[model samples]
Structures are given as C-alpha cells and as structure tokens.
Target: MEGIKRIYLLIGQKGSGKSFIGTLMEKEFGIKFIRVEDWAKKIKKDRNVDSEAYLKQVFEENENEIRDSLTDMDKIVFESTGLTEHFDIMLESLRRDFKES
Candidate 1:
C-alpha cells in the first residue's frame, strides 16, 4: 500500500487567514480541507445541547472524526486556531497519520 503523505496543518489565531490559506492549498494541491469549528458545529446540532459540557463533548467527538478522516487521505489541510490546549492532540494526530514526503 502507498504510505500516506502531504499533510499540512495551518495553525494560527482566529481570523488569521488559516482557512483562506487552506483554501488556496486545496486548490493548488488538490488536498482536502478539514475545518474543525464547522465539524464541531455539526456535531453540536446533532447532539442538541447548549451546555458547556455538551460543547466540550461535541468538540472532542468531532476532533476524532476529523482525525480519522485525515489519517485515511493522501493529502489534507487542517485549519484551526493553535491557541487551544488540545493543539498537541491535533499535531500528534497528523504526525501519526502521515510521513513527510
């Protein structure tokens, strides 16, 4: 099997153009773009919860989905704010999924 490669994680503060950069990368490199907040919102809608605990749960659940999707793709661009405490989790997920090419 071909080893996974070409994973890019755009980390920065909110409104810092990470998503825009990811969009450009997607167009230029034919990579998939995974936006974490959008995923979290989808999960939240499904769970139908407005509490802090529920939001946290939604984020965690969606993060796993995002990670799994990234792991199986050849090229993926993940855009997120790097200020989160769970940033390490995102980095480790990418590192574990793809080898530098």
Candidate 2:
C-alpha cells in the first residue's frame, strides 16, 4: 500500500557480509540500502582503528539524534554488524520513536 512503510534491518557480526546481502536485495528488488554505520561516521568522524565499531556504538546510544537524520522513505534497508553495546536498545527505541508518526 502507499501508506505502508517497510524497513528491513539486517544484523550480523563483523565481516559477516550483511552488506553483501543488502546489495543483492538492492540490485534484485530495487530496495534502497542505508547503512547506519555510514550515518554514524557522518555525524561523528573517527580516525582510530575501531572507528566503525565506535560509530555504531555512538549511533545506537544516540538513536534519537540519528533518527533525526532519517527522512520519509519506504522500502528502506539497513545493515549493521550489531556489535554495538546498545544494539537492542537502538532497535527498541526506533520502534517506539518511529511508529507511524
């Protein structure tokens, strides 16, 4: 339906090719892929070795702030390693915060 919004969240460990799967979905289904890690990097730049991990943690911790970066889009796909300490917290927060609003 036009009013329906579908968001596919892909979760896995580091180097687990979650993005590869997302890419395939994008290519096959024309679904737009949005990687949370990329948004995290845009919000806070890190040059350290574990920057990816740090950005993910920051994103999950500040779900509200990151959510602001999101726009109204349907059939969206998000892939993450779920290595952040607050991965579940972020998901729960997003569910509660972004419900048909």
Candidate 3:
C-alpha cells in the first residue's frame, strides 16, 4: 500500500448501518468518517427546508464547499451515495488542474 491513497466508501440505504461501520473504521484505524448526508442536512437547515429536495439541492448549491472541505484530508472514509459521481468528477478536475499548474 506504499504511496497508494486508500479510500473506503460505503454505499447503502439509509438506516442500514453505514455510519455504524464507519464508526468502526474510525475507532480501529483512526480513519476520519464524514457522513455526506450530514452536509445535506446542514444545508437543509440553513435553507429552512425539511423537504427531501434539499438532498440534491445541497450538492448543486454547495458542491464547491463540499469539495473544499475535503482539501488536504487524509485517512478518511466518506459515507455517500448520490454525490459520489460528482465527487469523482471534482477529484479528476483537481488532478488535472494540479498537473497544469
């Protein structure tokens, strides 16, 4: 695993124990666990909307914030679903930007 960046992503239905397993990784390996839903929840609270609409709106509106929050992080696990593809695109964009710079 030398020089390889390792990331563990757990995708599943809500209330299906994703956070429970994430907590295990946190305790056992000191991997930081970030619940993607928490961000949406925060945004929802900020917007004062209790609807599920905040789920997608959170990403659409705050993707940069989400991406920036992860800057320089290490040994982390992200529990996510819908945002995975968007995150991957962001990562690739960052890689290309770094190479060009």
lDDT of candidate 3 over 24-96, digit per residue (tens): 9989988777677777677665565444465446555444543454565444566755345555654465455
Whole-model Cα lDDT of every candidate shown, in order:
0.69, 0.67, 0.60
**Model 1 over residues 1-101: C-alpha lDDT tens digits?**
86556667787888899999888988988788878778667666546545656655545665576656656776677776665445565566556755655
Each model's backbone clash number: 0, 0, 0
- All candidates' TM-scores? 0.68, 0.63, 0.57
TM-score of candidate 1 versus the correct structure, residues matched by position:
0.68
Off by over 4 Å in 3: 1-3, 46-53, 60-73, 83-101
Ranking by lDDT: 1, 2, 3
Off by over 4 Å in 1: 45-63, 70-72
Which 10-residue window in model 1 sums to the lowest lDDT?
82-91
Best-fitting candidate, scored by TM-score? 1
In model 2, state the lDDT of residue 53: 66
On a 0 to 1 TM-score scale, where does candidate 3 land against the true structure? 0.57
How far out, in Å, is residue 59 in model 1?
5.2
lDDT of 2 by residue, 2-62 (tens): 4555667888887789888888998999877767666666656545636666655566645
